[model samples]
Target: MKIYTLEELQEQDVKDVIQIEIDWSMAYYGKEEIYKLSQEISKCFNLDYLIINLKGNSIGNEYLGLLAQNITKCTKIYNLELILEWNSIWNQGIQKFGAQIQKLTNLINLSLDLRINSIRKEGALYLGQAISHFSKLQNLELFLGNNFVREGAVMLLLEIRKCQDIQRLALEFNLNSIDDNDLQQFGQNILNFKNLKEFSLDLKQNYELTSMAQSKLVNQIQKCQKLTCLKFCFENIDQDEEVYQQILNSLYKIKRLTFFQLSI
Candidate 1:
């Protein structure tokens, strides 16, 4: 079921709708509007999968948390994709969002895009802790691009250790001020995700990134002996052909890797 506009949120029966997609991206909505939307969404008691796009909606922080809480009323949700990019949902918003969604203990896959929001370390910590509560999570994609996580990004990884069932993961922290030191620990934490077979990490616009750091991280990633697919992205790196060749050589050592992509 697809609800394309807020006007379509009628006070009607939709309890049998197992899957719902609300595409409201780039639409303008205020606090009151979101609250009402939450009320309507909560009535979908049998929802098993939801894909809501509120990106660029100019929605503020105060109501998104409540929306998160209301969405969990479905109880049967195992897959959720919430896109809140280019909004003003700051740390407080993410904290509320994260805390409320932890109630979905059955979630197996989640894709949360809070890009370009003014989130800091505290929000990252809260979000990570909340996500760690999901014992059944396997596929996860979190895009916190253009925020201020920095070293805090590592905290998210540390918490992700709890979801050892993760097999496919995509984390984008582009323009997050993360440097080599932060990713070294980040690399170490991900190595323990023994079930991880497909992984994508995007560090584009992380100006401090260098070939050396990338090499080190690749070395660490290779330790995930089960990985068959890998993708790495970064800003154009200044390196000689030999340096690039060496990096490629290191990546080639991952014998199980069937698909490899490195974008510099």
Candidate 2:
């Protein structure tokens, strides 16, 4: 549980590190400062777990690419969590960042927070291709809420479906342009995740979702006999009581289900 600031990390030598948490949030560091810090952190060869919180940082494509390049050098990292919410990163930056992330083939648990960014379909596709490189990933939590992702969501889900060992997944795509057909495709891809136990899908504020789509999604999810915990948020959709009841009936079919939540 060791925490280090950018200044501290740059000044001292980190060795034999098992876990390290780097907090660059709220810091007014310039691009060069971030690049130097990233270079320093890349020297730690024994680091297994790394957490980086970059909330409120105005990191651009070049600096983000530099940091990602250094991160790719840390081959021993197993669990990686990055918080880059509220940044100015766009599609090109995301693509470069994802290219570097693909080098971390040893990663098992990955959590990426790119909420409130300017990711579009191209960015989502790049990120999805990068995610497909993690064949051994077990736990994944991705926050892409409030972005321009629509058909890109389906592309990302298709890549995630390739990870056969993924057990727990929490995806946040609220306030996007995901429609009924896109959600149905997502549900269809999810059926391939046989090892998935806990799953949460947040599609709130997607005005295109209707009762028919909700039923179709429920029918697909009911096939996941291994699911123990399930959550769905579909607020502002056009679902009625009958549709809601159908979703509940589908949930009842999962004998192993312990936790169930639905918001409309």
Candidate 3:
């Protein structure tokens, strides 16, 4: 079997690379080398789609902030992934780097994966702020695994939804940290999303997704006209069967919705 590395990717004369996975190799290079190589690679490929997998040694917030600031020159970037764990040392770095990173204006699809923990709240906010600069963005998936609480996550959601161009959104809540009040606020924020075509959330795994929570969520979902696909996992309600049936019946008016999955 032939082992492929980033260096090997540099030699390839490909124009549009899709889902090229780079993992443990990041740890092999020093910061300077990593930075330089990333810059060279950005220049070499006329890439429209790029997927980065940071699966080994944790990528600090500072490193990601810097990479986001410098790599915006690529004209064809439509999809992006920057997944890193919560680094207490790097939390402050995200805000500082965020202002510089917002230069990526052409992105149409973006996926941000931030490890959930108390320390990541501010970093996730900074990351969301960075994404609002892309006016052309259509698909957005923000996975805030364990980083957000009610206030921080809600604020970020409200800000990101302001981008009228977005069509798809996925938000994951930290079940342990969020409660009823948080879900209510999140429900209120969802009302602001005007153009979404696909919406998904992992709300059932949390403490706040009760029958009332489901009612609030359903009420908000009814407001969006463009929504086509709905996927949500919520708490087991008292009337699970009847509620699910009612929810599906109400959504039938949406002409674009071809797939609907709701779980308790």
Clashes of each: 0, 0, 6
Q: Write the per-residue lDDT of candidate 2 for residues 76-121, one digit (tens) a residue.
A: 8989999988778899999889989899999899999998889998
Query: Can you write out model 3's per-residue Cα lDDT over 172-195, one digit (the tens) per residue?
Result: 764536666666777667767778
Q: How many backbone clashes can be found in candidate 2? A: 0
Model 2 lDDT at residue 174: 84
- Of the two candidates 2 and 3, the one with more favorable TM-score, higher being better, is 2
Regions more than 4 Å wrong, model 1:
none
What is the TM-score of each predicted model, taking all chains together? 0.95, 0.96, 0.80
Question: Which ranges of candidate 2 are over 4 A from the true structure?
Answer: none
Better of 1 and 2 by lDDT: 2
The lDDT of each candidate is 0.86, 0.86, 0.64
For residues 172-261, write the lDDT of model 1, one tens digit per residue: 998999988897897789988989999999999988877777777887888888899999887656656766877787777888999998
Q: Poorest 10 consecutive residues of model 1 by lDDT?
A: 4-13
What is candidate 3's TM-score against the reference? 0.80
Clashing residue pairs in candidate 3 are: 116-146, 116-147, 117-146, 117-147, 204-233, 204-234
